[model samples]
Target: MTSPSELPSTPAPTTEFEIFRGLHYRDQPLVLPNAWDFASAALLATEGFPAIGTTSLGVAAAAGLADGAGVTETETLAMARRLAGLPVPVTVDIEGGFHEIPSAVADFVKQLAACGIVGVNLEDGRAGSALAAPDHQAELITAIKNRTPEVFVNARVDTYWLSLDHSSTHDRVRRYAAAGADGIFVPGLTDRTGIEQIVAATDLPVNVLYSATGPTVATLAELGVRRVSTGSLLYRAALSAAVDVARAVLQDAPVSSGIVTYPDIQRLLPAR
Candidate 1:
């Protein structure tokens, strides 16, 4: 692995970058699925999703570490490297920059870009359930854009997820937009009124987290949201299915759940 300090100042053009960015504004809102590893990502690609995103929760839990604690940097990068060969564009959830210095954030993203990831989720939430000052978060976004301009920077604002009001969110989004962010993500804000306001507030594409109780994708598209992400939902569902099937088998009861065939999974790899 190339050390962050030795990362190149400029990166060559990535083949998937333009395609990934264009998916945001297509006829339908981009419904991004979060994948934890190569098999999950490759399966989704075969299932016809145009792009894939990495879930920090799934990545951390699979490695027996905690999410949002800034402990998964190495693991996250390693997973990105392993999944680099997938057929679709891959974006990663890099929680909270993982370092105090803006340049270090740039260096970490540099490594992922080298691995061919086309996008990233850089959030503003920190440890201890607090939010980073808006200026500080925007500085991090600017640094990433400076070092890796080809990578789509999805600037995540965790205000609603942290149970805060919407008063200052527009301001925060504005600051991040000026910093050259390719898009804006507000994970917990689901109401159309607020969603509409955020989309109208900036020219940047607005990305919302997929909420079962929230507006559907078609509805969100009508209201002008360009992207909706399934963050960690698939990972949690996989865990539940794993436990359920195991319990059924041990009790000598019929397995009453869906299963993927071994041959189908084997097809996910490219022919060598």
Candidate 2:
């Protein structure tokens, strides 16, 4: 079994970061799938995803902590350390920076960089039913960039996500872009018109969440999106499948014919 430290503790090549950033601007959008832990990330890398994003929901839920509560900092870094050993670039979701002070967020990002993570999703969504003041979120983004200039910082605006009047959504995007964000991420924004508006408004890469009711990856690429993220969809779908399988097995129903072998994951685990 290969421990994280035993595998390697060095940052990936600088080209890895460039390759990840370049993926966003290719003719096709970078379709990023979110992974919760080592096995999930390893599986995605083995399946040939050039990069993977961490889902805060899956990280918190796996440990009985609630997402967006700022309680999983240690666990998040721990997972980052493990996933650093994978063959592809890794980006993390540090929800709301997990701290109020801008410098603290910067310091946290430094830690992630040490783990070889090349990018992060820092959102403006708040704990309460409100959005972080755009100016404040920009401050955090600036501080993180000042501290970790090498890490790709994706600034996420939650205006559309919170269902707030997005009269100033474009303004928020501009603020983040000015603050040195490497990309712009807008979750819950699916309208082709609105997406095009945002895309034309900034030179930074535009990232949108994938929606079942909205544009597919190819459609998003046509609309000028640079990246398409699955967000928590993979994690949620994994949870659903586990529950459904458990119900079937407990109810004496015939189980599915096969399951993917997890021996490689076992090999990667340390023997007690």
Candidate 3:
């Protein structure tokens, strides 16, 4: 795999608006693998993920902070800077902007843009509110575009996740699109009918959260989804695997001998 430094340093989309549009027409759905930190981001980039996203849950957990609480802004930005040096594009999950003011959120995005991030996921699950008022969230989205138009604004609407009325999802998506969002993310939506309705109703690309029970990738493609995100699934899976491994060791259960050799692991380390 090519080193991030070896990749061309194309200037990010000149405007956030352009970045949002560019992500939609790609030949296939953007299969984004969310990473927790530098090593994960680097390995995923090396594995040829054209774009990588930061998982807020993963980041916050690593820092011993609560996810979506606005406590990891500095940590998130630091990770973005490191990822910026990688070959593929990096889009971060900025949980609710860590602040209510749109300008504060926009300021945070400007720092990310300066670090070479091409996109970000700004969700609308307001702290404590069932959902941030559509108009209020739209204001934040518009402010971000106005401040840093080159960063792809993935405006996430968590209506379904918050157990709010599903009917409001479409209206919120439309409002986000009008607010200069490049893509719309509906994470808790899984059913075929609901997915189709959202896709049919929105002009922007619809990003769906991949669920084991939801339609398969092929089905999502057929239904017009332009992006599929794993969200915290990978992070959770890693935790589960670790716990299982620990239990096996404690119980003296036979373990697979096909693990990577120390030499192989050493090969991945940067030069001393």
Candidate 4:
């Protein structure tokens, strides 16, 4: 693991972004585990995930705010600060830059760059609309990259998630890459053909959100995907497991097996 202190001094933003990009497509594609808070990020870092990411859904849900509603800017910033203190590279999901205006969004990326974050996932869900106008979102991406060239901008197009009537995922990716996006992320992309198309269409590295129905790491790598993000899956699974355990205890049913022991969790916790 590369410690923050050991990283080159005065590193260019593009340099840092390339380093993270290089982690992808290596022996194994970079499997990014998303965390909502400091402890979770630190725990994953301690467990040897070379990099950690923030989940917008988990961050918003923990604060009782609506996810993808642009309500967690401050919370995300604070979380970035906390995660930066960890030993590994930190990437944050600044959902849609928490604002529509390009300058406002660009300023937000600048703030994140100052917080020692090497990368950010900027989505184009467009608040209440299905997906932001491709041109409008591309403007935002270009503004962010021009302002903070070193920050890896993982431009996320949520056409699949929003169930939009888009015929060309390749076209969408091309627009973002022309706008200077470092990488392209297509969440809710589970089909092999679609994944392969996007991976081949763009020169930028492709990031796919991990789904139970989606291709496995080896398969995604085989198809030329560079990064696989867990997104909100881990957090959602943890919630589901908690509910299942509680229900079993109340009904006098047997607890699930493979529960991590308290001692194991203790060892995972940061030393006091």
Candidate 5:
């Protein structure tokens, strides 16, 4: 594995945005690992990921707030600021842009871009299995693009995620693309037919949330998925592993040897 010291420092904002955008066009889908904090982001970058994204669930849970409730705006921004010095470009998941007004959402995104975030995942899913209207969501995308065109806007259609309107996926994908979205993310879409259909729906790069039970990375690449995000999986797995290790210690059983060493983790961050 390449050490963090061997990797290049953060690139200029415009170049970084271009690099993040170009990752989606590679032969293999960009296997994005969502990081909840600086250590996770820095570690993933040291391992040579092209880019890193923040998981709303991980960030919100870590901050003791609820995900997708528009309650994590400040926490998300703080996370972005902390990640500004990483070796790879970073994207933030700003749930519903943290506001109802399009202009307000744009203003918030402007702040995120200013923190060296190259992209953002703006979902349309609301609380209680509801979804924002397609037109209104498109307006939000437009406002964000108009405010910060260099920042890659990954418009997230939560039809499958929220289970609200399955048939509207194609329409929403096209709408967001027309509204100047740099990519389309449809989480909870697993089947091949559905994946192919969404890929064919728009020319914009398609992103899907990685699922253990879903098709493999090669399969998704064949289906034309440009990006696959492991959203919250790492954070959740870390939590589970910590609990299992604690139980083993209590029982005087051998703990897992695959754990990262304290010194290794300490080396992940440089002196500030």
Candidate 6:
């Protein structure tokens, strides 16, 4: 089997969208770190990430809203506007497009594209943990593409995440690909064989949610995965660190070293 690294490199990208799209067709999979807010996004950008993504769960949780409940559209858009100035391109998760109507969903994505966002993760999973009809989801993908051809539409299939009828993964991905999705994201798929099969199922880039216990980045790259996302993991880990440090303070235990200082965070903010 030929490795992506051995393949010929493509021409240089001329646009932000092209830059982001090119990240998927590289020697190694694009390891995307999901940020919940401007500070997190900025920090990741300064740390040298090629691009940044917004975790729907992280955004919803920070705003005290439930993830995938379709209640954080405003907050999500607000975050996109705030992160537009970051050095790297940004993609956001618009859970189920925040509306049942395909056009309305596309309109919301247009708002993000206007904010200079280069990509979006539109999932088929809906409120109440139900998966939308494949055709309906495809309609949503088509509408977004028609409205904003430049924005990378990462059509997400939640069959694996929701653990309902895993057999539908191939058909769903092919349907979205036919509908013009720029990529396919399967969030709970981590096993090597599963990843390989899905990557083989479509010509579009394949994105998998990063799992601590799953295949490593090098392994995923070898499996032909194109994009690996740390969805909500960073935010959750930050929360866990905060609680742990507080507990240590109460116990008079030595704090963890190498933690980011207050000044480091202050520096990440705008000068004005």
- The parts of candidate 5 lying over 4 Å away from their true place are 1-14
Error of 3 at 85 (Å): 1.1
Q: Residues 1-272, candidate 4, lDDT per residue (tens digit)?
A: 99998898964435555667668647667999999877678778878998899899999999999898889999999888777767778899999898889999999889888988889999988678568888998999999988999888999988887878557567779999999998999998899998888988898889999988879989998999989999998889889999999999999999999986778667756677
Candidate 1 lDDT over 1-272, as tens digits, reads: 99999897755435798889989868889999999988999999889999999999999999999999999999999999988788889999999979979999999999999999999999988887888899989999999999999899999998998876568899999999999899999999999899999999999999999999999889999999999999999999999998989998999888974599888888776677
Ten-residue stretch with the least lDDT total in model 5: 10-19
lDDT order of candidates, best first? 6, 5, 1, 2, 4, 3
Task: Count the clashes in each prediction.
Answer: 0, 0, 5, 2, 0, 0
Q: Is candidate 2 or candidate 4 better by TM-score?
A: 2
Residue 57 of model 2, lDDT score: 94
User: Best by TM-score, which number?
Assistant: 6
Worst 10 residues of 6 by lDDT: 6-15
Q: Mind giving the per-residue lDDT tens digits that candidate 5 earns over 105-211?
A: 99998998898888999999997779999999999999999999989999999999888889888999999999999999999999999999999988999999999
Q: What does candidate 2's lDDT look like per residue over 1-272, in tens digits?
A: 99877896756446767878877877888899999988888888878898999999999999999998788999999999998878889999999988999999999999999889989999998887578988999999999999988889999988898888699899999999999999999999999999999999999999999999998888898889999999999999988888888999899997666665678677655467
Candidate 1 versus truth, CA RMSD in Å, comes to: 8.5
Error of 4 at 47 (Å): 2.0
| Local accuracy of candidate 3 as per-residue lDDT tens digits, 112-190 | 9998888989999866646888999999999999999888899999999788867888899999999999899999899
True-vs-predicted CA distance for residue 78, candidate 4, Å: 1.4
Output the better candidate (1/3) by lDDT. 1
User: What TM-score goes with each of the models?
Assistant: 0.92, 0.91, 0.88, 0.88, 0.94, 0.95
Ranking by TM-score: 6, 5, 1, 2, 3, 4
Instruction: Quote model 5's TM-score.
Output: 0.94
